[model samples]
Target: MRRESGRIPRRSFALLVLVLGTLTATGPLATDLYLPAFPDIARELDAPQAQIQLTLTAIMLGLSLGQLVIGPLSDAVGRRRPLLVGFALFTVASFACALVPSAPALVALRFVQGVAGASGAVIARAVVRDVFEGDEAARFFSRLMLVTGLAPLLGPVLGAQLLRFGPWQVSFVLLGAVSLVSLVVVFFALPETLPGSVRRPFRVVSLARTVWSLVRDVRFVGPALTLGLAFAMMFTYVSSFSFVSQSQFGASQQAFALMFGINTAGLMAGTQVNGFLIGRVDTSRRLAAGLCGALLAVGVLGALALGGVSGPWALVALTSVFCVMMFSVGFVLPNATTLAISSQSPAVAGTASALMGSLQFALGGGLSSLAGWTASGEASLASMAVVMGSVGLLAGGVFAVSARWAVRPAS
Candidate 1:
């Protein structure tokens, strides 16, 4: 699963990037595209606010657990099969979600959708590592994020527009239709990036050993955890933003969509900058700088939020904090993933990628749920902001400490 000899052919290269980028976007589509519908869902299903938030938690948990199984299965078998199977399952789950009668049923279906969606997200990264290594992999991931980031930028706006013409169910129907398209593309265009010669057996003992090995490696573990916590901070906002914008700031749905898009634009810009800085500046230095920036951004956000500010100034300050936090994440994630994956055996790229993805969402899901609970009814951003600030500072500390004592991957 090391870098393939010579460059991929131009047509094949374009095809890979296009398909993988779309595939990488499924998770965002699943989460972000339906965000504006939360209030509608709560009303229609007769569910409490906490329960609606828990639905989001369910999906995150499903995504976290799904990668743990799918990654290893891809390692045992091949990338294409799992992708096709997962897409099919995702399509069905999404369609079912639109038809579910109760909040609990919808939550259950969303969990299945997340599990099915995990295939694309997990495999896209595995395929990248399958084809490239080291800084090249980092650059490719940043480029991939450039494509993937667009989903978040446009998803909420898309959802809001859908809600204007129809019910919230329309969003799920749209998810199904888009996934059907992804299925066709994967089936026709994606190749088995992991060839038979290098594929590993899917043994429980072996999987455990590989995971444990990654955990024991300080270089991999530190950046991996840093990536997770950074994402958790971002997800804190993602999970809480609807309430924050609407309840705390008194924004209309359209205004909220516009604001969400603006902040996501910051994230998109950061990915492009990350791609540029990949080889020019060392990835480690860039990662450390990103974490430091995130720490500062979240700290300021927490301070302003707790200081009891109000009006447009408060809204502007919050959006600024979010943009900076997202910018930092865009820089940190790809570099951390590149470093962690580079440390593992190519034979176990799928397993390693799976562990990283699983830990990220698992941590993210827990943190998101915590934010949701703390912000319930009251819709207080201050508590969540403080938690995010703490996480940002901790992630920075971890990166600094790991760089001093951690083992570097083999060149």
Candidate 2:
């Protein structure tokens, strides 16, 4: 989709990305900020572990469903209204979560928070699609990646800090405050990117048809599957790393967080490399290099796991390989997203973005859960690696096959 003719200043474009990136980061921020408080929440609410865990489940389910609803709605309504409403609701829900007396109430409110938070993740991409085309969108996505990618990984770390000063409720209070700031920013900074001229009316049957057509398009599904599965790989690694590092490898909490911080930095580094290579290197080659790097790292990881390796060397090996894998992923996500959203017509940008976002949330959750359950009790580095390797292969395979039917893999 071509942007409107007037050239947007670089400073303004960067500001726009920052605003949109924060919106995109909110879902993950809200999802993970309360994670460190789980133990306290369970104890205070007098709920079983299973019941308390439902709150996490509730938010994820809400995020997945919320994207499906809000993305298409934004296509019909225009970006500004749905987005502001979502930001407001998320802020309200964050405060409400802090005040909930019962575990069930918290779960319900978290669902609302998640649903509201979806506006940021969904429309941010649609807005990028609206405002930037081709190479510029890819570059912008790399920048957005820095915020959205880091927030959830950073959330628990920040939550652990909040616990030092106050009870678990402080996490929600902080989330509310941050989101309130986000709401204020959106009020003033973010404009309606989707104008009336290109807006699609909200019609159920028509929506279904447009979405179905998008699904049937090889171009959208290919990169989207690549994006979803790549995310599944990253999410699996992120969600499982703590358990694998500490439970199986016996790393201390500080040590694990340190290692986690380093690996996460690798992810950011990969994006920077990708950003540098955007115009110089072929996009498909960058994606291939990422997939190949992840696949190789995970293969080694799986072998170490299945071979019953252990001790400090195993720990060192795993951490090093994770850095490589995460670095590779920096290249994958932005390019994949660009391919998926940018290929679609401007009219369906919101729907397309939402569908991809939903898949990302759903697949990331589902695949990570699968790795956990498939591991039986207490996930190990090896099991996590196996899941990562399998997912990497699937992502690579899907992209390789699908790209043949439509666009070149960039190489």
Candidate 3:
């Protein structure tokens, strides 16, 4: 039973968070670790730089579609089975990505890797929802964000070092090892969160109805859109910034890594602050505060871009603004997740988590790629600013429009 006290016997809670955080982090680690290797992969594979960005798009598509399938699948069968199966696939795909002979092949493997990695994200959220609610769930998610934030903080640096000493493939090997270790942890440390008594058998009609009901509910829809749109802003920055920094500002690989890590640290700081404010602030108010901060930073980014800022000063300016912007993102992510999941019944938490994640990756990955494509098939610092600002405005609008129905839908 979930304790409203939000206690899990300190040591056990620490272990549980570690295990779930590791699971939750797999996709991001996969995504972020390979970022520094983009130029190398493009050069070695004889592909255009623009085409290389497509690989990011493909994995995101897989992540979106995978959550749609695995979330409901876990609801019907169980989180344990789907998680194990997904991790196993992730390990295999990670290794296979190391051996692909061409960009197209690598993209195909990345899509599979993304699909597999998504099982971890969807399952982690469902597990949290299964065991916690209200303030307790929100606190746990803040902790979870701190864990996930480490991926971008460390991934690019590790990837750049690997690329410097070895090859781009070495990064994929690391991902494979991480998944293999995660498999063992899942089997030993994590237990099934979804109970058999509440599991509805996987059925097409019932699945459709459950999804429809969730989709139309503003309580769930508002926070989920809020989360997804904000993520689109973040993910576009994460996926495309290497090109922006290197191609536009003349940054080296190591410099880019450090830059990425610093911004990520800002994000973790935001989450840490959110954790401290758990009882002091309500979710909607905090979320609104975050949107305001992010939109304000987005304005700074737009001014710099529109002014045609370039060279080293532009680099310093962009990094500072990005750090401040991502700091606010830390607040947006965890609180939005808690609201959406808490609004759902545990019986369908898997589905609810899945829908949120699907929209998150799909919107996050899909629309931003167009920015790169429109910029003559290459991402630039200016284009990143423009696209993110547009999306941030849209997210703010959604949150404002949906404020009336923030409470859970009547069952």
Candidate 4:
């Protein structure tokens, strides 16, 4: 909605920040909180490792697909309604997942859960665009990072403790409860950020046209793909880390959780620094610099892995570099997102945001699947390192090309 002069009221702005932060954090926490329980899930469900891995894929697929639908629907209808509906579905699906008796059933439920959970991930960003532009949007996104980044750091620890005291199913139950709480809070508190005047018609051809235009637009495609590739790097690591830590490094689940927390801490630090620098540096330069740093770190880590340095400390060192690269993500993600949405009409913001989200999760899902197919406990460390490094390199290339094509010529 266009606020009078496009400025949000202070109270509305504060609430927007809280809602966006909560929504952004929920998807990651849901996906990651039970990571330490993966081994146990396989054992309890009497499923093979590959079957257990499908649950993750299902969630990712649902997330991408849901956003494709939900984002456009939000544009046609409104933000608050879609969010409430998605949260309600997510809450129910969480309970369904907790109660599922078989691995296949659980996978199916997780897919449904992901679809429902997509609202927050897609709409939160769109809502920011709805309310703010340029530097203000960048600042809002950074604030979002403050809360979203904390979830990963905290989720693993919480998951570890829950696994220690109870069955792995407890994690799903807890997620369901959290979704319910979020639903209630949003139902009462979240305003309809998308005003009716700017709402697009809900026609199939119109939606397809919006997507086609976005795909063809250099401005949208470049930043959107950059964000997607950046996310793919993280997904590759998340998908493979457990096997590497447990099989290669001989770390317990608790140990892995601790290490994961450290990496998230690095991400938080990066987000904070990026927040401070958003207004000072040009967004394009900031993204280019961050991408370069990530590329270098990942390259070095890959070299170490290739050189037969497979010890625990080596893993830790490489992981720390990965974490530092993660911090630089703050520089890239928000800026790319802001750029992607900036050129679109307000009528199509939801569709544009949806496409961006869909592309990101699609990249993530594809990479995670590839990692699962190629990984083995014996070669887990090297494989994970290679995957992360390769994704980083690919992302860097994408950003460089996008920058060259998209950046304006100097006066």
Candidate 5:
């Protein structure tokens, strides 16, 4: 259904935000909700560290690959149907994940779950672009980030709390139930955002050419890469933190959860700040500033890790740096996404959004896997920090170049 042109009314605005933001939260909810169970899953399945970590990688692969297909399908058919089907798949896969008796089986199921979960994030972004543009779009995304941030903030703590009473399998069961709720909500609350008049024809060759067009559009490619790299930095932290806190600093599961919450809180705060600032500052300027902050934070983080700092104070300091990194991500991501998707026409919003999401998840998953595989028994904070810092620097560089030549959305 078509929304009114210009500003959406308050009631509709509130409802759209609630539904889209919840959909956007699915990625983190799927990934982070089970993280506290990682160690336990490893032991229970008799899997090697790398193999266990591969489960994370596998899901990321699913998410990345799934978006490549789902985005175009959404563009062709409309948003609501793909979303319903995807969530149903996620729910079923989550239940299967709970019943899996081996690491390989669990990994396979998680991959399917990731593929299913990805529809929410990709489609949610496309839906936002379907209805908004320019600074308004950035503002909407920032506000959406405020809601999406809750997933990461509470996911680990909830997982840790659940572990207090039951085996890690319960976490998967819970995930299945959450997906069921999401499925019900989407079926009831979400109307088809893509109208028939603007829908792209579904064809493989046509979709490939459309994707290739986006690939060559420096206007789209630059910020897309920036967003991807920014996500890579965040996922690196997500992948390493539990090990880093527990193995390196002797933090218990609960303590690690607290630290995770603190970092996500920083991310949420940044998104809120962006929501306020998007009208006052240009999106490019805001992006540049956020990248600068990230560069500085990651630099300090690397130095501290390499210095071999230890103790509770050291953990506190490290967490503080990570918080800064997350805050920077909050600023960079929404703005970068605005820059990327706003350049595309509505006809290809799904394809454009899909391409961007695919790149982000691919980079994030790849980096997380590398971090897991390279680290020894103890956490390799120095190496992870260096990797994160280097990516932060590269993302900043990409944005600087892109902002100079990129097309701006109409105000």
Candidate 6:
């Protein structure tokens, strides 16, 4: 919130970190926690499996659209009001989801829940920029990731436990309760991050200008593309994992959750590496390294999949490599985010953050959708691996070109 840009009290900083981390945690938790319940949900609602998967796409659409609206609004008005409003909406939507009887109704409610859930993620990054800049911002984000990454690791496990003991509704109830608690905490503890001096007019023309400028900026685009590609890779895995595990490998839901946890563990490891390296290396170099590493790992995984090597040990080996690629994700996301926000005017930080997030979600959503289309029989896993690897290679190529252009002397 509106604290002076000086030495923040350690306790206050810790609280701020907690709130920011919690805000960032919602989407990943929402996506991953319910994954274990997907097959069950399809059976209970008598919905086709493809239709059940579309619910995830619906949620992602809402998340992308919501940020487009909330980001600029937060810049125009203030961060606190929009965030609190969003949390309130999220709390209500989660309950609505829990109570919905039909698959279509639940899908509709999940879209609303996603819209509400988007605020924390969009605002959390803006908040980071509100207080810190450059490397400091990178460090703060890496720390936030430590907390946020835990959600993916823990969410599925928790969801598996819930589904094992209670009905699927129990998961939604848990989400609603978590939202309620976050709302109360924010109301009492979270302060305004953007001050009045930095506020911008919320006019449509002004918002359009901000978006135009952001899209045109090479510095912003480079990192944003990197982040988008990395996320796309991850989402490809998420979108196809159920089909892969069930049809291809015949793994139980519990086993699949455990595998998900193992993959998420790679994300945690990457975040730790990012925290260690952010302060030591140049951000651009760190990003390049990450992109390259992801490209290589994804390439190997794709090759393995394409070679028709389908066994338990082979699957685990390939998945493990993909999981390790997640570590590089840490190096890419925060750096790209920092570059985008730092390149923008402070008055339009909300708009900048919003566009960055919106594009990331839109790209990931598109990739996931593409993966869904490629879901033919058990070979969907191989298709997913190819898509992810291709995207990563493309991103690495962009980063390489950017570096060359940036370093070139006047001709």
Q: Which candidate number would show the highest lDDT if scored against the true structure?
A: 3
Whole-model lDDT, model 4: 0.81
In terms of TM-score, how similar is model 4 to the real structure?
0.95
> lDDT (0-100) at residue 318 of candidate 1?
81
Candidates 1 and 4 compared by TM-score, better number: 1
- Which digits, one per residue and each the tens of the lDDT, describe model 3 over residues 1-411? 385322344457678789899998888899999898888999999999877888898889899999999999999998899999999999999999999999999889999998998999999999898888898889999998888888779999999999978999999999999999999999988877777888889998999999999998888999999999999999889888988888878899999999999999999999989999999999888888899999999899989888889866877888899999999999999989988999899888999999999999999989778668663778877788888999999999998888765543542
In terms of lDDT, model 2 sits at: 0.82
Task: State the RMSD for candidate 1.
Answer: 2.1
What is the Cα root-mean-square deviation between model 6 and the actual structure? 2.2
Each candidate: how many clashes? 0, 0, 0, 0, 0, 4
> Residue 11: error of model 2 in Å?
3.9
Best by TM-score: 3
lDDT of 5 by residue, 1-411 (tens): 235531345458778888988888877887888788788888999987667777888889899999998999999999999999999999999989888889999889989988998899999999998888787788889889988899999999999999999999898898889888889999988887777888889998999899999998988999999999998988988987787777778888888898899999999999889889977888888888888888899899888987898976988998899999889888999988998999998899999999999999999999755665453643478768877887888888888887766645432
Q: Poorest 10 consecutive residues of model 6 by lDDT?
A: 1-10
By summed lDDT, the worst window of 10 consecutive residues in model 5 runs over 1-10
Clashes of 2: 0
Tens digits of per-residue lDDT for model 4 on 170-242? 9999998989888888887777777787788899998888899999887889889988988887777776676
TM agreement with the true structure for every prediction: 0.95, 0.90, 0.96, 0.95, 0.96, 0.94
Q: List the residue pairs that clash in candidate 3.
A: none
Q: Ranking under lDDT, best-scoring first?
A: 3, 5, 1, 2, 4, 6
Worst 10 residues of 1 by lDDT: 1-10
lDDT (Cα atoms) of all candidates against the true structure: 0.84, 0.82, 0.89, 0.81, 0.86, 0.78
